[model samples]
Target: MGRPTPDYRRYRCTIGGEVYTVHLNPRHGRRLLDLAIATGSELVWATTWEQYANDWIAPRIGLPSLPVIPLTSDPPSEHGEMFKTPHVAAYAGRRPFVWFDDQVWAEDEEYLRVRQGLADFLLIHVDPMRGLTSRHLGMAHEWLTLTGFSQGS
Candidate 1:
């Protein structure tokens, strides 16, 4: 009748054949919100706010309504909302998601790094005054790639 309900908060869709069932984490791609929007990706926010899409994020990124997920918990950062579910990695699909934060996913778990193919494990870190490798995220990406999890395309 209509689009099937979203199974994973983030997932690469395959049920309908060649279409990609994917959801973009607004918090994770705030900077690339415009990039994602331009790419026809969806955005999820947990609470209502000034229409960033209609006003700024959309005009720049060229998309809108990028649906908000509506959070029932505190935002992970002061600027954005938190993931609807912390353990919901399934929604994130198998893509190497890059999230903006002052910290890593887990500080005590050796950062659960993972990679799948010869895709150059990459992360475009954005900081006003820092280089692309800020937060040493590339280091983590490298770690994942080196571990034979990622093939580095």
Candidate 2:
């Protein structure tokens, strides 16, 4: 007899045996695209872990394949400090940018401010539990407007 197939509804963590499931907010897709258009900001993917994002996360969230900010070399430390800030600052190269992530900290913001030195940068933090909301989008738009970085600027 063949072995039984495992149930897909829930997953058992190998380390802790804790069960978990995924909940996706479909509205984020439209919201993200709308924000990008409204802010005239190009969307790019920056993640600590890229493989899962490319294989699973992006499609479910309705984001198309985007240029990724490589982060494997300097992964996020257990203390929650971010490693992507420097790379992103270097990649943007004095260009204006707004980064949205759940893990940004005060140190990261200060680092960018000092490193970029006159570049327009906004670091918006989102709650991982709630995901992205309309309010966050509004803030991004406001920042761009305030900074005089509208569309083609």
Candidate 3:
């Protein structure tokens, strides 16, 4: 019930002209997502998966259909953040947020830091190969506690 391993169940993926396999232990993800949701954190899809996350990944991970962040064909950020960073920042729009992604980079953090100003945020980078873990949830919970969200604000 920790990181996803090569020996875990495999799911084939053929999206965006890339073909690969993903190994997942859905229980861990389900548990983490459930806790996040229960603690009043809104979950939204901000991935290339887009609607497919609601159609596929959510069900497997026992999550309800969450809102999808509509990605644009806009160019990358001037500061060299991920292509999705601008859209994510726009969607978040001054609200505190915690973004989780496998591709999060320092540039993305910097962009959000500058964009959000005094608003608090956290970025949890999931290892594409290893998947999420309790430690990741611990980080989220700790952030929530420090931000006063754990008390159900």
lDDT of every model, 2 decimals: 0.36, 0.69, 0.76
| Highest lDDT against the true fold, candidate | 3
Off by over 4 Å in 2: 1-22, 75-81
Clash list (residue pairs), candidate 3: none
All models, RMSD in angstroms: 15.4, 8.1, 3.0
Quality of model 2 by C-alpha lDDT: 0.69
The segments of candidate 1 whose C-alpha lies over 4 angstroms from its true place after superposition are 1-56, 64-70, 74-90, 100-125, 128-153
Candidate 1 per-residue lDDT, tens place, 1-153, comes to 233223214444333255444333333334344334333333443222334334433433335455543334445643232243233223444544434332223321122232222222233333423322324444554454554444332
Per-candidate TM equals 0.30, 0.75, 0.84
Best of the two (1, 2) by lDDT: 2
Native-to-model Cα distance after best TM-score fit, residue 34 in candidate 2, in Å: 1.2
Model 2, residue 9: what's the lDDT?
22
- Cα error, residue 48 of model 2, in Å, equals 1.9
Summarize candidate 2's per-residue lDDT along 43-129 as a digit string, tens digits. Answer: 887875455555555676677877777765766544334778777877788878888898888877777776456458888998766
